[model samples]
Structures are given as structure tokens and as C-alpha cells.
Target: MRTPASQRALLVKISENVCYTELVYQRVNKKLSVDWSHSETEAWVQAILRDPDSLVEQRGKNYYVANQRRKSQLTVNSHNYRLITVNRLSK
Candidate 1:
């Protein structure tokens, strides 16, 4: 089993990007007052990255449960999320 510290680090690393398909978006936002846009999703996942303890559930690679209702069932592939450390330079 992974240590608590190691697991926290892994959560931070994987939360770099929270990937989801259109179907996920539609289903998730169907009852919500606001639409779950990409930017919103990114921000929500980033918040979780900042605080892994906030996660209500971590069920393998397919799902994560955050405190926020809209972000609970998000499909985040930590391995697939690209790590962009630097800001883009303007041409």
C-alpha cells in the first residue's frame, strides 16, 4: 500500500488536468443551474490538487469525488493530464 504522504503527492500530480468527454459534461450539468464548462472544470480540479483531503472518494482511475457536486464524478486521468509548468510566451 502507498503511504499517506505518497498518496497525497500522487493526487497533486494527477490533478494537473481533469479530462472529461461531452457526454460527461452534459450528464453532470443536466440538473445544475450553471453549465460545467472546461475552464470551470479545470479550476475545480486545480482546487482538489491544492487540497487532496477534500476528496470524498477515489475509486481507481475512472472516478474522483470532490466536495463540489458538479465535480464529483469528473473523469480525471492523472497520467494523461499534460503538465504545463511555464506560461506561453507571446509571439
Candidate 2:
């Protein structure tokens, strides 16, 4: 019989390996790079992360969120920095 799509090794591996955990008593950890991928998934991933909004395609198997910033007139005058936000959700 064919393997159930949800039970596939690739997807299961991604979930087990990609997610991070922290102790409830301690502050959360921060990461600059979300180091998870396969050659097949890379192009699809780029299509999303490269967007101006910093959003990715988020296929049914996985989700990715991102942050982006552009210089603003007020920020330029005030010498402030641009801001960005990134988030993700997956089933």
C-alpha cells in the first residue's frame, strides 16, 4: 500500500528536525537562520522569502513567515532603522 501523505518520511523529518524547544522557566531562544531544506524545496522556499512582504508560499506541508523593512522618510530624517517581522505556522 502507498504511504499516507502525512506520514511520509520527508514531512515527518521536517517536523521533528525543524522545530525548536525551550524551557518554560527560561527566556525563548532567537534564531537568525531557519536551517531546514531539501534541494526540491529550496526554489519554492525562495519564491516566498524573497517577497517584499517577506512572506513565503506556505504549502500544505509547511509554513514560513518573515520580516522586511524599507527606509521611510521619517526614519531617514530621524536616523531610525527599518523594522521587520517574521512568523510561521504548520500542521
Instruction: Name the candidate that leads on lDDT.
Output: 1
Error of 2 at 28 (Å): 21
lDDT of each model, Cα atoms only?
0.49, 0.28
lDDT of 2: 0.28
- The superposed Cα distance between candidate 2 and the true structure at residue 38, in angstroms, equals 2.4
Q: In candidate 1, what are the lDDT values of residues 39-78, reduced to their tens digit?
A: 7746755675666454423455443434443333334544
- Model 1 has an lDDT value of 0.49
What is residue 46's positional error in candidate 1, in angstroms? 2.0
> Alpha carbon lDDT of residue 11, candidate 1?
69
| Model 2 per-residue lDDT tens digits across residues 1-91 | 2244432432333323332222211211122233433332333333333434432223343343333442110100111111122223222
All candidates' TM-scores?
A: 0.51, 0.21
Worst 10 residues of 2 by lDDT: 72-81
Q: Which segments of candidate 2 are over 4 A away from where they belong?
A: 1-37, 55-87
